[model samples]
Target: MKALLLAGGLGTRLRPLTENLPKPMALVGNKPWLEHLIVHLKQQGIGDFVLAVKHYADVIKKRLGDGSSLGVRIEYAIEEDLLGTAGAIKNAEDLLSDRFLVVNSDIIHEISIIPLLEFHRNHNGLVTIGLTEVEDPSQYGVVELDMSGRILRFVEKPNKHEAPSRFINAGIYVMEKEALQWIPKHKEVSIERETFPLLIEKNIGVYGKTINGYWMDMGTKNRYRQLHWDLLDGKFTLPLKEKEQGKGIWLGRNTEIGPGVLLVPPVLIGDEVHIGERSVIGPYAVIGDHCELGRHVRCSETIMWDKCKVHDSTQLNNCIFGYGLEVGSRHILHEAVMNRAVGVIQG
Candidate 1:
């Protein structure tokens, strides 16, 4: 099966991080976020991929390159201007198979695609949207479905009082090639707002299948950090090249641990990491590759990207450090996020 990954968003919500890298390329568990999704899809037996790219498209191309290393055949669909979800898929119509899976690259979830495909095929629908129940329906595009599982209405970000259901569109879909015909060419269109509603009005088959599993949209900094915490806490397992040093603790090759250093469980330390004496790290911490940590430093619930250097006597809690950052001595950083360009430390 072929999959169309919508990865073109500018990631405005994840500012400093996205400023340097695309959302899909954002580091999660010391690997690109998109890599996890691709690996998941590949495990499910999907091979060919069409990546709809816009923001920092070249960087993604360079990083993923022909997808050979990933064991998938990848094709790029570059959009010159901002194209909404359906519009982006329409732009890549030429690369799409007769029936394909469309997934939003920003989301991390455990839902299986096999059942979704079966549901789509059984219903013979033009488009079948994956729906999941959320506590707050106001933040998502809620879907109202008939008893037969056919979509009756689409409400985009409804108010709490106005919401008709708790089930929201999960940003995953199975679509037949004919579904692309509904999307107009050379135009910005939203599948939720325009295409799906138009199909419903025209009496075309647009179905909704409720899926049960862990699902999160890693579009915000807090959620991004939480994803790491979840991984370490065993909410889900991600494939890592590093060896498991202990329960909930993974260490890469040549990682050094100094005398009197305390490594709490649920920590991931990357390659060539050096932890100084008497330093306490993690209950949930992700130390990226080539990081140098000084003595008496304390880090908890933090994510430090590659090549970061933390000076002695620094304390970081609930912090995120981007690539190549250098911290001054005696700094106590709590609930902070720092990146390269905007050096202004945020809490």
Candidate 2:
């Protein structure tokens, strides 16, 4: 099946990180999170891809040129302006097959599409949305389904007491090409807010398929942090695994650890990393490629991007550092996020 991935959100909430990256371009486990999604979809017998991109489309184009490297054929539908979810799919109308999959790029999941496809085909629905049960349906658009799996109604962010169901829209959809007719072109339109409701009002063949697997919306900073922590903690496995120096400790090539340096497990240190004597790292530390840590440094729950330098006696916890930071001596940071693109020593 050809899939149209909504890859164009501004990622406004991910401020510093999205300051330089599209939401899909955010790094998780030292690789683009979007790459993981592509690999997942490709594994499910869906090879042809259409990335409907708007924000930072150039960056995506440069990094994942033609998708040939991943053994999948990819095409990009670049939107000149920010198109809402449904509008984005409408924008890529010509690229979709008679039956297509539409997925939001900001989510990660462990669902298998085979069953969803079977349900969609059997029901002959205009759209079959994947549903996942959530504890707090109060924050999401909850779905109510009949015994036949036909969508009954949607409650947008209903209070817990008023909520009719725990299953919420999982941002994954299988749609017939004709469903595009329901959406208008050349303007912002929300699939959830407008089109889906219209189809329901018309009593169209709109269905919901419940998915029981790992699912997460990696749209916020905290969620991004959670993704890394979960992966390191063995919650769910990703397609790419880093080279391990020890159990739970992944070390890239040419990474050097000094004498008396203490490394806790579950740390990811990238290539060409140098750790000085007496430094303590890990228990969720991610040191990117070409990074250097000086003597007496202590870091935990930190993610430092490529070419970062932490000087002697520096301590960091729950911090995220973007490219090329040179932290000075004896500094301590907690819950800090730095987005410095230039290489500069900090004092």
Candidate 3:
């Protein structure tokens, strides 16, 4: 099957991180977030992919490189202007199949597509939206469904008291080519606000399938950090395989731990990492590839990107260090987000 990956968003909310890289390229488990999505879709029998990209389009193109190595045929639809969700898909109408899957690039979900496809085919709907129950529907596009699983109403970010249901749009949809007609040409059209609502108004078949699995929209820094914590806690599993050095510590290739270094469980240290003597790491720490940690350093609940250097006597908690960052000696960083261009130091 063919799938459309909407990866063009600027990710304004995830600033500093998204400032240098596109939202789809955000790091999750040491891999680009979009890579995880691709792998997940591939597992669900998707062999062809069309990436609709605008921001950092070249970076995405270069990294993915025709997708041949990943065993999929990948194509790109570069948008010249800002096209919203449905508009982007309309921009790639020539590349889409008669029926295709549409997925938002920033979502982290594990819903079974097999069942969703089954539901969509059985209902013969023009579009089928994947819905998941969220604790706060006010932050999402809420959907109300009838007894037959047909969509009855759509509410974008409704107030808590006004929300009719907790099930919100999960950003995954099975769409038929006929649905494209509802979207106009060369304009920013939101599927949630325009297409789906228009279909409902016309009494067209629009269905919602409430999925039972892990689902999250990693659009903010807090949720991004929480994703890593959840991974280490075994809440979800990625496709990558690393050697388990201890009970809950996963080590990559050639990782070196010095004498007297304390490694708590549930830690992930990437390849060629060097940990100095008397240093303590983890309980939810993810040190990326080729990182250098100095003696007497303490790191917990932190994510250090590739090639980061931490000096001696440094302590980090609830922090995120971007690639190649250097921490000076005796520095104590807590609740911080540091990168080459920006730094957020909170107590």
Candidate 4:
């Protein structure tokens, strides 16, 4: 089945990280955020991908290529203008056949789509959305479903007092071809704001499937940091192979751990990462690909993205460093999320 990846958003909330790259291209683990979503969908038998691109469209296409490397056929729906979610999908209607999946590339989730699709097919629903319980439903589009899973209402970011239910839209959906008919072509429209409510009003079979899985919206620095911590803690499963006989360590391909380093378990070190001698890492740390960790550095619950360099005596705790950042020797960074470039400091 084809999947529509909504990758066109400006990602204003992600800030400096999004300033240079699109949110989908942000490093979440070792690869770009979009890569994980694509891989996950591919594993679920949804291979053909249509990425709706806007900001940095060329970059996304350059990085992902034809998706053949991941065993999927990839296509692009370049949005010349900023289109809303419904508009983006409507633009790609010609490419979509049968029941297809829709997802936001910015969110991180491990939703099992098979059951969701099954429910949609069995009920012959116009749309089936993936819903999950959240502590704060007010922050998301609150969904109310009947006993039979038919959506009673779609409340967009309701206040706590006005919330119909705790189940919120997971930004993942299985859409029947008929649902696209509601969306007008070349117009800015949101599925939540326009199409979903319209479907409910028309008594169309717009329903939801509640899923209990590891799900996170990495829209902020705090959420992004927590995602990496969860990954290191083995809270979620990936398709990649695990490291043998290592406690709390998920080493990706070609990673090198230096000697005399005190590594506490639950640390995820990605491919080609170099942890220098006498460095103390973890108790919830995530080191991304090609990182250069200098000697005698102490890090606790820190996340360093790809190609970052942390020099000697730099103590990092509860911090998240974006890709290509540099920390000089003898510097101590605590509880910080650094996204911009840093100049070298000579002691």
Clashing residue pairs, backbone N/CA/C < 3 A, model 4: 248-266
Ranking by lDDT: 1, 3, 2, 4
Local accuracy of candidate 1 as per-residue lDDT tens digits, 1-347: 68999999989888777787788888888988898889899999999999999989998899898999999999999999988998999999999999999999999887788899999989867989999998889988888899989999988899988898999988999999998888998789998889999999998999999887778889899999888888888787788877898887899999999999999988999999999999999889999999999999999989998999999999999988888999999998888888866666776
What would the per-residue lDDT of candidate 3 be over residues 231-311, giving only the tens digit for each residue?
888788886555777788899899899999999988998989999999999889999899999999999999888899999
Model 4 score (lDDT): 0.83
Report model 4's TM-score to 2 decimal places: 0.92
Q: Could you list the CA RMSD of all candidates, in the order they appear?
A: 1.3, 2.3, 1.4, 2.9
TM accuracy, model 2: 0.95
What candidate 1 gets wrong by more than 4 Å, as runs, is none
Preferred candidate (lDDT higher): 1 or 2: 1
Pairs with steric clashes in candidate 1: none
How accurate locally is residue 63 in candidate 4, as Cα lDDT from 0 to 100? Answer: 89
TM-score to native of every candidate shown: 0.97, 0.95, 0.96, 0.92
Model 1 earns a TM-score of 0.97
Q: Give Cα-based local distance difference scores for all models.
A: 0.90, 0.87, 0.88, 0.83
- lDDT, candidate 2, 145-196, per-residue tens: 8999999889999999889899999999999999889898898999998899
The C-alpha local distance difference test score for the whole of candidate 3 amounts to 0.88
